[model samples]
Target: MLYQDHTSVVCKKQIFHTEFILRCHYYITTFDLYYTDQIQQTT
Candidate 1:
């Protein structure tokens, strides 16, 4: 029973880590696009 609980905790951690990475990637991509648009407008 303890082992099963540990496995479940690990799985949850993995899911959370994956979600965090994806969110960071989305934010970075959005920022990059916005930055490019701003630069283009200035020139």
Candidate 2:
């Protein structure tokens, strides 16, 4: 039972980390798009 609980905790941690990474990637992409648009408008 203890082992199962530990496994579950590890799984949850991994999921959280994955989600955080994805969010960061999305924000970075969004920022890049915004910058590109700005440059295009200026040009």
Candidate 3:
């Protein structure tokens, strides 16, 4: 029972980590595009 609980916890952590990474990548890409647009407008 303890082992099963541990496995589940580890799996949850992995899922959370992947989701967090994806969210960060999404925000970073969106920010980059916005920044580029701003630069283009200034030029």
Candidate 4:
């Protein structure tokens, strides 16, 4: 029972971590695209 609880906790942490990484990647890509567009317009 204890082992099962520990595994569940680990699984939750891993899922949360993956979600955080995906969100960061999405934001970075969006910002990069916007910045590139602005630079292109100026040039």
Candidate ranking under TM-score, highest first, comes to 3, 1, 4, 2
TM-score of each: 0.96, 0.90, 0.97, 0.95
Candidate 1, which segments miss by more than 4 Å at Cα? none
Find the 10 residues in a row with the least total lDDT in model 1. Answer: 1-10
Candidate 3 root-mean-square deviation in Å: 0.4
lDDT of 2 by residue, 1-43 (tens): 9999999999999999999999999999999999999999999
Model 2: lDDT equals 1.00
Q: Which ten residues in a row have the lowest lDDT in candidate 2?
A: 1-10
Relative to the unseen true structure, what is the Cα RMSD of model 4?
0.5
Itemize residue pairs with steric clashes in candidate 2: none
Query: So what's the TM-score on candidate 1?
Result: 0.96
- Top model number, TM-score: 3
Q: What is the per-residue lDDT of model 1 for residues 1-43, given as tens digits with 9 covering 90 to 100?
A: 9999999999999999999999999999999999999999999
Instruction: Put down candidate 4 lDDT per residue, 10-37, tens digits, no spaces.
Output: 9999999999999999999999999999
**After aligning candidate 1 to the native by TM-score, how far in Å is the CA of 22 from where it should be?**
0.2
User: TM-score of predicted model 4?
Assistant: 0.95
Q: Write the per-residue lDDT of candidate 3 for residues 11-34, one digit (tens) a residue.
A: 999999999999999999999999
